[model samples]
Target: MRTTTHAAQAGGEPLDVLIVGAGLSGIGAAATLRRRCPDKRFGILEARSAIGGTWDLFRYPGIRSDSDMYTLGYAFRPWTDPQAIADGPAIRAYVADTAREYGIEPHIRFGHKVTKASWSSAEALWTVTAALAGGGERVLRTRFLYLCSGYYSYDEAYRPRFEGEAAFRGRIVHPQFWPGDLDYGGKRVVVVGSGATAVTLVPAMTERAAHVTMLQRSPSYVVSRPAQDRFARRMQRWLPQGLAYAVARWRLIAESIFLYRLARGRPALVKRHLVAQAQRQAGPGVDAAVHFSPSYKPWDQRVCLVPDGDLFQVLRTGRAEIVTDHIARFTERGILLASGRELEADLVVLATGLSLKVLGGAAIEVDGSPLDPAQAMSYKGMMLGDVPNCAMTFGYTNASWTLKADLTAGYVCRLLSWMDRRGLAIAVPRRDRAVASRPFLGFTSGYVQRASRLLPKQGARKPWQVYQNYVMDLLTIRFGRIDDGVMHFGAKGCLP
Candidate 1:
């Protein structure tokens, strides 16, 4: 984490590629490029000091992957862990290990945040301005730019304004920036918001807190599964690690796709099944209908998962409870409900959600003209329309993020290889006016709905649309031809 930065780390020659962010997507891209494009030189610029993005940033109690590690893990790497749902620290260590194993650490430049990018038509290069972590600046030039920074804001999570919050005497905390030394032991804690964070926090805080209460305006669909993956265990015992991982990954991906489709097409049937699963987990003491039943369908937002029914166990033990009502205002002792009731809490955890910040708030310019990322239509969910020699790795919302990221990285290498063979220096998606614009994402979750307007738009037609399906993306990205009619490829100053 060097702070003294006058220039972009002294690169004598222009880099073949410059990847932003050292997280999963960025590291994966570097690994793919290293292997596929062995002759090209590249560097990864990471804003943070460490590797793992969400896993490293979030230190809140009970922070764990909502999805199974088999699917969440990279396609090339085998996840040997028996636990399907892994905790934050373990996941972070896994990412760190992956980086070391793939030799991507050498290409990483930490404490360097890219602030602006200006592409030169004459030079066929992108000159990037990055702010060094401490108090300096650096400039780097590369033929291709890859933005792997995740969509959410790193500086702050979404925090909502509550009435009379200033007068509240209890400590209010957001899970995004969990205090290192804050102690909630033996305290009556209340977790607000019914998303994954609130569900995870309730069970974790129960072991230490005197009493934990989950207060939500409405319920979210939550289903509990065994922490250890039974199939993964059996497969690992019989088959090789890599083969077992690939098999389990495909099975889970298929199951997830089937379930999601069912939820969308036959929402009533899917909703009933989920509700029954919740009731079975709750047993006789707790009411699943009151706590687990959401107004939306199963996949409307994301379905929260509780490993081995930990949340239910805590609730059955009387250490935790759930209350569904709107917050009228914040009282000195606690929060007042819209129903004229008040609940007391010594500590309040705001599991509100995330703030979406696309491209880490970096400014992009092409030929001295400012390029608004939001205005540019997305091309194959990886490349932006009218943006040449640039790719953005955005993963599937329904499945593991790496599934799409790896595919995107592979396609990028393919494109680069093709361009080199043809002596071409640039490739940009030329938008078609006939194509109708659609929302980049269609999820109705609060965070997404709030930030959808700022996100890049997708086209209604093929090659320009982003299908969240892995199979479609595999054919569309991994096996698809690089010379799509929409993409313009040319030598330096040859085509304008």
Candidate 2:
């Protein structure tokens, strides 16, 4: 790793690849790059002082992986823990350990928050600018820019204001920026939103709070699975460690794919099964249809996961309640619902969703022209149409994020290798004007819908389409041809 940070080292001499964000995708990208393109110069620019992006950022109670660890864990690393559904700290440690194991820690530059990147076709390089966490700024250049900063803003969360908030006496908290000194013990807690966060918080807060209520405008589909994978444990007993891990990983992947396909193919059948399962899990009193059954089909938005029916168990205990009603206003003691019901609470948790941020909220330009992501089309769900020498690591919406992130990293490495072999300087995905454009993501989720106009569009065909399937992505991105005619390559001093 380069130790110097002078203007020349920072900006003058260009790196082979510059990765933004040291989170899950960024760390995985670095590890992949080190293995695939060992000799290439690279650096990871992390805005925060530490690694473990999302895991490190969120410190809310019972913060854990919604996806199973077997699939969420990196392709190269084996998640050997007995618990398949690991918590936030464990996942963060796993990521940090992966970086240490791959010798990626040395290449990471902490406190460098990337602000903007200007791509010069003439120089075949990107002039990147980042703000220092302490003070001042630093400029750097790279041949290829890989954005793994994630799709949501870390600086701010999607926190919608409620009427009469100032009149409320209790403290209101957003899960994104959870307070370390918060004391909700013996207090009536109300968690807003029926998303993954709310579900996780409801059961967790019930442990300490007098009572916890999950208040949602609408319900979300919830799936309950064991915390530990019995099959994984059995595999560990029968097979060697590596082989066992591989088996468990593949098993989970296949199961998720099958389940997703089933849900999509037969939404009504899956919906009925989910509702019935929730009803059985929650026991007699709870109305599954009224609280657990989502209006949208499964996988339309992400299905919330509750390990070992934790949420349902809490609901069964009567310590937690799921209320489906709009918030009319914040009352002095609690919240007033649209149904003319009032729920008294001492504390409120806004477990609302995240705000979508494209490219870590960094500005991108090509030939001194700013790139509007909304106008540009996505290429293979990673690169933008007409955007040269750049790739963004966006994961699958339907499956574990790492499943798609790993494939994306591998594809970027392949692209780099292909360019190296051919002595090429630039590679850009040329847009096919004939192809019809569609939304980047196919979800009715509020966050996605809100950011619809800000996101890039996907084409109706392969190479330009963003398939949320891991199998298709693994086949095409990992094994498919690099020079598929869509991605135009150029030699030095030549623009694609």
Best by TM-score: 2
lDDT digits (tens) for residues 309-359 of candidate 2:
999999998989889999999989899999999999999999989999998
Candidate 1 lDDT, 262-344, residue by residue in tens: 88899999888888888887777777788788888777788888999898888877889888989999999999999998899
The local distance difference test score of each candidate is: 0.88, 0.91
Instruction: Write down the worst ten-residue block by lDDT for model 2.
Output: 1-10
What TM-score fits each model? 0.97, 0.98
Q: How far off is residue 151 in model 1, in Å?
A: 0.5
lDDT leader:
2
Candidate 2 Cα deviation (angstroms), residue 266? 1.0
Model 1 has a clash total of 0
Cα-lDDT of candidate 2:
0.91
RMSD of 1: 1.6
Candidate 1 weakest lDDT stretch, 10 residues = 1-10
In TM-score terms, candidate 2 sits at 0.98
